[model samples]
Target: MDTQHDIALTRALAEVPGPLPVSGVIHVAVPHASRFTVVGNHLAQHAELSLTAIGIGVYIQSLPAGSQVGIKALAARFAEGETTIAAALRELETHDYLHRTRERLANGRMVTRTVFCNQPGALLRGGAVAPVTVASVPRPVVTPVVPAPVVAPEPTPVPEEGPPPVRLPSRIAPKPPRRPLPQPREPTPELHRAASALLADLRRHAPELVLSEGDVEELVPGAAAWLERGAHPDAVRHALTTELPQPPKYPAKIVRHRLTVLLPPPLPGAQELTAAPRTPVTPFQTCEGCDRAFRSPAPGHCRDCRAQYWEAA
Candidate 1:
């Protein structure tokens, strides 16, 4: 048999007919003459042997040496479930078409070795069984890894009480400390002012939705996040307070949910974090007592009106 011709034949069969989108040697089995044998014949024609099992065996056989093969890897190749791939592997093992034997290395690591013998007596040339190739056990290489050179620390200076020490070159200085990671910048003065005004308005309009100092802290970050996304403060406030009933319960919880869930898409420069107003303010909640605009997320009267009403009482 002409071995050179066989190589040429294999290449010719695997050649792409049109433009090759990908340019890498694929580790795949082509229409080799020896691939067609009694076992392959039976597998291809027999309904008992599922096409999946045959394909699985072919894929495994096509893998290059030392390539990792797992149920997950196999399933990914065919876009099938891991369980399905595992079952197909079992079928291949049952038919003596493939198998895996484990070998533990000197480093206490166990590795699975895949062996292929699907066409038991079939070779690529004729329908002759191909010889099974078993890889020799991998001996662990214990090559000593040379560690990096250590920098000697500076020697501590001794007091003059001792006899004059032998004059030698000065010792090395200690390494400088590593710089700390940068923390997020505190909210800008403008940002703080805007956020506080929003908080006050929310509280004034929704008197039932009172916000504590701690609640304000929790709510500010979410609103800032929306602002960073380029949403106007007014939009964020409306989205947060629009659904709340007058004197709504659990103001903190309702506001947190709204801030997190109802975030608007960032406008072009909203992410730039400027203090200047990008959008005109549109008031949503107004004070019940004085009919003034609501400033905080909580339901309530404006500070001036609420204070005056208390004074009158």
Candidate 2:
């Protein structure tokens, strides 16, 4: 492999191993704009192919640790709009940056490993690109949007028939048309009753369970019907215990109270606990060939450095 190119690749990878934005292009420059121009030109031209080929590598580096790579997640990062996940994954295999491993998850979903690009591959080592021979690749997944259910209108009621021959005209003038009666409000007695009952039951059975205002709001729906029927407090309590079998238990009360009590008083300008003392490690001799230091005990110098030192001697 070309050492200079390898060095540049490593440097660029170090700079952009994380999920970086396009704005990070400035970090690629070493010091001066002139040196940056030379490096930038090379990357923009010769290194572009390799850098672009490692699209999945860039993606793998960006992912959270232990997270299984999914096609949806890959697509959102790499393809975005220009290409589909299926296409990018296919190309990735061609570049030898990723491989698929099949397994069954606990939920019985067919799981696959989207391998990292750290392992040596022919193309990655500047070898020729090989043809992909895999029989099956995951297709681009698009979730379909489901429309809401349609409700049909109720049929109109038919009018009763009247006798046509016996028409007794009692009124000398035409009578005014009668207006339609307004629909009665829907019955909410059941709702109020249920809410009231639930509240009462909580107070009686699970008195230890401290409920917040939000919790009460949520519980009210259960006893709404009872509340609407002018339910007495005692009747509401009885109805709640009888109707709802589950007692109101606040699982988080102990946790909340514990948290409140255990909270340490705020220490303004408090210093952190002193770290444990560290034992002295063996001294490392400086390399003669390079600036790197080695931790070998009784070492004269690094092998490479010693060789250079001897050559100069």
Candidate 3:
């Protein structure tokens, strides 16, 4: 009976579930003998960094010296767009994991240099290992043995020719005359109001075009000139807003440049307004003899009436 009880207890225990197997990551780490990068837990488990940024930081740290890590190069290697890669690089820079600076090369070309820090905190705290300086050893001076003295020959001088030839002056090409700037029309109250409204409304099409009140007032004359020249309001707006720089440094300056440089010529009919007026046509006159209307310079008679009177004479 004891054996039976023991067997029953063993069966019951076997049937019961032993704490459900822990559901979590299991490390299967392998010791790397070569070509391995050591990443600190601070960076690998960074709370603020996104997965892409952390991964990029680690990749940059692992790269050999003088590797191309520009946004375009990184984008080509990874499955990310240039913008995303650039943002990740900026994130690494912000966290002190990376330092990028624009340097001008000896050839006068600008280049960006990137420096990766394995231990950002250490670097920030100025904890970098000092370079080892080797002490210079003194060498024993050797005595020189003197031999028989030898005489040296002197160089022969050449005779001078007549006066040096005169050099002709180089001909300089004449510069082309610059185009005259377009002058703004005399601004009336209506023109000023229209120009102001156009300048203010530019921000609606492009948020970067936001202008201050003073800038708008200053730009009003140029915008008015565009309008006075036969350019439609839409055309002027397109000229001002289209193909703007990635981030316009000075929006008002851009508008002013476009207004002055791209101003259209005035309408053809506009210039012909000073021509003489046309003479009026002859009016219709009623002939007194036949009671018939006819076109004449005066109201006296028609052609037929004048012919009859002449015949009677």
Can you write out model 1's per-residue Cα lDDT over 1-313, one digit (the tens) per residue? 6999899877875674655447676444344322222234655554665778887766655554455556766667678899888888788777766667776656555666666664544533356433434334345422222111111122223346778779888798989764331111456666656665676578665566678888886567666666666678777677866757665768887877777667666565656766777785655568888788866666778889888999999
Judged by lDDT against the true structure, how good is candidate 3?
0.76
Q: Is 1 or 2 the stronger prediction by TM-score?
A: 1
Candidates' TM-scores? Answer: 0.27, 0.23, 0.41
Clash list (residue pairs), candidate 3:
none
Greater-TM-score candidate between 2 and 3: 3
Candidate with more favorable, higher lDDT: 2 or 3: 3
Tell me the TM-score of model 3: 0.41
lDDT of 2 by residue, 40-96 (tens): 222224342454444544545344345545566555655454355556556556645
Q: Going through the candidates in order, what is the number of backbone clashes in each?
A: 28, 26, 0
Arrange candidates by lDDT, descending.
3, 1, 2
Alpha-carbon lDDT, every model: 0.62, 0.47, 0.76
